[model samples]
Target: MRTQIAIVGGGPAGLLLSQLLNRVGISTVVLERKSRDYVLSRIRAGVLEWGTVELLRTAGVGERMDHEGMPHDGCYLAHDGRMFRVDFRDACGRQVMVYGQTEMTRDLYAAQDAMGATIIHDAEEVALHELDGEAPFVTWTHDGKPFRLDCDFVAGCDGFHGVSRPSIPKEVRREFEKVYPFGWLGVLSHTPPLADELIYASHERGFALASMRNPNLSRYYIQVPLTDHVEDWSDDAFWQELKRRLPEEVAERLVTGPSIEKSIAPLRSFVSEPMRWGKLFLCGDAAHIVPPTGAKGLNLAVSDVHYLAEALKLFYSSGDGSALDGYSEQALSRVWKAMRFSWWMTTLMHRFTEHNAYERRMQDTELAFLECSAAAQAVMAENYTGLPY
Candidate 1:
């Protein structure tokens, strides 16, 4: 098989890249290890930044989102039993949309199919080769049949476990990692939202986030030990701990029904330097992962694919590789900026016992200052809602 580009994963990154390319009359193939349903239903990021929503709307996938998605002007910062809101619309002329990753995946999947793009699901044992040769090779097995795929370029949209990064020469690869002591125990329930906008609460007990997947479905998360098991946390146990962190005034309103599903995700910051090597490029979690506090993961993935699609379009149109050549550095500039924002938000809400009493007191002061100062609110609003993509 041959294509202009071979996308290694069918997640949002891969699908979006394929869609953009197809728009410009480029052919690509997407290979996914998971089945189509699994990829569309995966529970993941639910917040869509304004920039991402705009991009999706331009790509013709935002009609459903614009109709079904809930818009939030800002989020609430609840600490010490007090709540203050930072109005993103007022500060930055931007607002976030409460659209789940699954929905975006489904939309893109439909768009890709409508455009007549090739998507191979349940692919197994995929491998990349000839990265240094004139043409790159992608090989995979599906249903016990092995096949070889050749393409001009390969995109490793696969997640962290994908082999794209590992294919890099050991001597040329550089890695940066930071693992947190905490993880988020997330839950999805069929309950009306307790709040109109998401509430990010910081308490002595732990960190809690209240968000919505839709008008009738709510998605929430609470910080827990990294080693905690999802099975070990019973329904009663989940609510008991959640009540401690969430504001008491809003606790009663947060309806806890028989949970539809639950899971625990370890918090970590991971980055693989140089998102591109030879004929292969990485996007989304494949290149870097940001903690979920800032809701940047899904948005970052869209941005990466946006830049990548534009670069490829230019490459084919003008026969210049300048845009592709600068892909890594250009993407890194925004990646690092988002990294800082996510890290700051994580530390501000999460408990760190390593801090001395004086440091703790200083943190409290900073929070209080941020709550009242317009300048500080503007900073959070711009980063939270997103900057121009």
Candidate 2:
């Protein structure tokens, strides 16, 4: 089989890329290792940066999101038993939408079907060949039968564990990573959210975030040691711990319910340099990973798609490869800025014992500044709402 681009994953990043290309008369085939139902069942982050929402609308998949997603103009920050709001719209003229990733993925799938794009589920042993050459191809097996797919380019959107990054020779690849000492123990339940907007709290005990998918579906997370497991916390225990970290007033109104989903994700800042390797351009988690503090992972991946899609479209139209040649350096500039922001937010909100007295004092001073200084709040608002693509 032949296509213009062969996408190696069917997650939001891969599917959205294919959707954008389809609008411009580009043909793509998406290969997924799991069934469609399995992919939609995964509970992931719900925060959507404004830029991401715009991208979806341009791709013709934002109709449902516009109707169902909640919009937040600002969020609250709690420190020293006090909560203060940072108005993103006033500070940056932008606001984010609270649309769950699962829902967004569903919309993309519906858009793909409406457009008649090809997506193969249950694909196994997906492999990329000759990425450094002009005529690259992908191979995979379905129901024990092998097939070959040839394309002019390949998008390695299969995520962190996928083969796209490993395909780059170790001699040419450089990786940078910092693993934090803690993880986020997240719980989802069908209870009313405690606040109108998200609340990120930092107390002597640790960090806790009160978020939501909608009015009734609440998503909350608390910091835990790296060794902690999901089985360690029962629903009652999680609710109690979360209430303890919140302000007294907010805790008084908090609603608790049985958790429908529970999981733990380690915090880390990682980046693989040179996002492009010949014809294989890595996007999203494949190229870098940021802690969830900044809500940048999914948004970053879509940004990569935006840039890569623009470059590829121009190249195919005018027969110029300069944009493709500069894709790595251009994308890295934005990636590093986001990495710094995520690391900064994580440090400010999370409890780190490794900090000395001076470092701890500095953290307290920084939070205090953010509370009173309009400039600091503006910076946070711009970063949280997202930087220019």
Candidate 3:
């Protein structure tokens, strides 16, 4: 098989890239290790930066999102038994869309199918060859048969654990990472959300976030020890812990229900530098990862796709490879800023066991300052709504 670009992941990043490129008459083939059902079954973050929302519209997959997704002007921060709102529009003249990653991926798949784009699911043992040479190709197996795909370039959107990142030689790739000591115990419930917008709470016990996918589906999380398991907490216990961390007033109106999905996710900030090597370019989790506190994971991936797709488009149209050469620098500049923001937010909201009393006081003071100072709030709003592309 032959294609202009071989995308080594069928997630949102790869599919969106294919969607954008296909619209401009570029050919792409997406390779996925899992079945389509498995990909769509995974639950993920719901908040979308305004830039991401616009990009989806540009890719022709935003119709459903704009129709069903919630748009919020701001979110709340809870501390010391009280909560304060940060008006994104008032501070930054922008807003974020509350749309689940799963739903967005589904929309992208539908669009891809309608356009007859190539997406091969359940591809096994995918490998890249001659990535540093003029000719690059990918190989994988399916149904006891070997296959090879020759392409001009490869997109490593296969995520953190995928083969794309590891394909880069160790000597050429530099990585930075910080693994948090705690994890988030998240629950998805079939009930109305606690509030109109998301609420991030920092309490004496731990951290909690009250979020929603839609009016009838609520998503909530509470910080937990890394050693904790999903089976450790019952639905009632999870709600009680969440209520304790939230502000009294907000918790009063909370609607409790049976949890449909539950899991524990450890927090981490990871980045593999030089997102491009020869004909291979990394995108999304394959290149960088941010703690979820800033809601930047899926949004960050979209930005990477934007950079890569445009670079490829420019190269093909104008015969100018400059954008392709500069893809890493441009994407990394924004990636680092998001890394800092997510790290700062995680530190501010999470209760670290290693922190002393003085450090805890500083966290409280920082949140307090952010609540009262317009300048600080503006900075938060700018970062939260997303830094420019």
Residue-level lDDT of model 3, residues 1-389, one tens digit each, is 99999999999999999999999999999999999999999999999999999999999999999999999999999999999999999999999999999999999999999999999999999999999999999999999899999999999999999999999999999999999999999999999999999999999899999999999999999999999999999999999999899999989889999999999999999999899999999999999989999999999999999999999999999999999999999999999999999999999999989999999999999999999999999999999999999
Q: Where is model 2 more than 4 Å wrong at Cα?
A: none
Model 1 residue 36 lDDT? 96
lDDT agreement with native, every candidate: 0.89, 0.94, 0.97
TM-score of each: 0.98, 0.99, 0.99
- Candidate 1 per-residue lDDT over residues 191-283, each given as its tens digit: 898799999988887899988899889988899987789998988898888878887888867788878989999899888888999999999
Runs of candidate 1 with Cα error greater than 4 angstroms are none
Worst 10 residues of 3 by lDDT: 245-254
Sequence-dependent TM-score of model 2:
0.99
Best by lDDT: 3
RMSD of each: 1.1, 0.8, 0.5
**Could you say which candidate leads in TM-score?**
3
TM-score of 1: 0.98
Q: Give the TM-score of candidate 3.
A: 0.99
Q: Which candidate, 1 or 2, would have the higher TM-score against the true structure? A: 2
lDDT string for model 2 (1-389, tens) is 99999998899999999999999998999999999999999888799999999999999999999999999999999988889999999999999999999999999999999999999999999999999998999999999999999999999999899989999989889999999999999999999999999999998889999999998899999999999999999999999999999999899899999999999999999999888898999999989999999999999999999999999999989999999999998889899999999999999998998988888788888999999999999999999999999
